[model samples]
Target chain A: GESVGLHLPTLSVQEGDNSIINCAYSNSASDYFIWYKQESGKGPQFIIDIRSNMDKRQGQRVTVLLNKTVKHLSLQIAATQPGDSAVYFCAEGRDSNYQLIWGAGTKLIIKP
Target chain B: EADIYQTPRYLVIGTGKKITLECSQTMGHDKMYWYQQDPGMELHLIHYSYGVNSTEKGDLSSESTVSRIRTEHFPLTLESARPSHTSQYLCASSDFMGSRETQYFGPGTRLLVL
Candidate 1:
């Protein structure tokens, strides 16, 4: 019964604006969370990741926030550009295994 | 960039034919995985291997079989390809550093069974 899901299927944002994608998970025992970006016809690329003990983590142009109380995770992208447009997925890892449970991806669209 | 690679970036095959999806990584990662994804859908783990000769089925039940005979190569085979097996197969690898090790992925193989 462990599953991860996104709050929205698509998000449209103006170029240079910020984008926020949300994810929720049902397994409280999951200790690791990761964010991935998948371009069309390509595999999921690792963007950033955070542990259960951390509430927030930042990358070059992205940030991942984890809220354990509500079982929510969010990825924030700054200065959204056309090249930044892609499907973003959030995954949670079980403590006993290395496999990741993926969430429904959120498609980020950038408008000129 | 990740050094992972998948062969036959796109494949169109007839039903009942056998097919193998090749995946290789030059990063020397100890963990490798195979995931299935439909168009505009999330990924589902089909198989994984912690090291050579250690293969395990993932959460999703898949008819595809995988072998880890070498450290850099993990291939998945479909004994009989079916229309229902049409999907994109992604290969990923990660080191056994810790729980939060980042997974690097290859460009994936898109298979269409006619």
Candidate 2:
């Protein structure tokens, strides 16, 4: 059974500080990984993604790092702000049908 | 920001009642998906469609059925809703370019079966 899981259920960080959310995946065959942000009462929004061929990818102030050796994925948000307070999720995509295996979300809270 | 839309943002219905969740996308994406999520829980894929007239069941087993007669519209129908079906339903659409496929989601529908 393939599954994705988060290291922490909730993470608290101060504003203007960097935040790191970690995820672990069980499938070695998964080649694509994605990060999504879900605001309260809203659907998840795409943040960043990384392919197995690459080690890291950056988008705006967000960065995604993938370590295929350890089957780990991380999302780095620089200068965490109040707007960054949301639930973050990591998903792994297999070759078939492009369906993604989602993990339990990590709630990122920014302290004022 | 995605053009995807879901109707009946909040619904409260009795058990055994019929209900339908509407989902539509203006992006002309070839892929569409329906996901169920409980509060503070992981998302479970319930249904997905590759294109018009092509629908498939996802990883999770669901009692609801879906129809994709038009490219932009994909709706889910629950013939006999139950209390166990109470949850948030999200709709998403994606268009892949080569190996890059990103799903854009809509504001989910919150269903409460009383």
TM-score for chain B of all predictions = 0.95, 0.96
- Where does candidate 1 stray beyond 4 Å? B97-99
- How accurately is candidate 1 docked according to DockQ? 0.73
Residues A71-103 of candidate 2: C-alpha lDDT, one tens digit per residue: 999999999999999999999886565688899
C-alpha lDDT of residue B102 in model 1? 71
Best TM-score among the predictions, by candidate number? 2
* Model 2 per-residue lDDT at B61: 84
- How many residue pairs of model 2 clash at the backbone? 0
Q: Could you give candidate 1's per-residue lDDT for residues A1-112 as a string of tens digits?
A: 8899999999999999999999999999988999999999888888888899999999998999999999999999999989998999999985677778899999999999
In lDDT terms, which candidate is top?
Answer: 2
How do all models score by TM-score?
0.96, 0.97
What is the TM-score, restricted to chain A, for candidate 1? 0.97
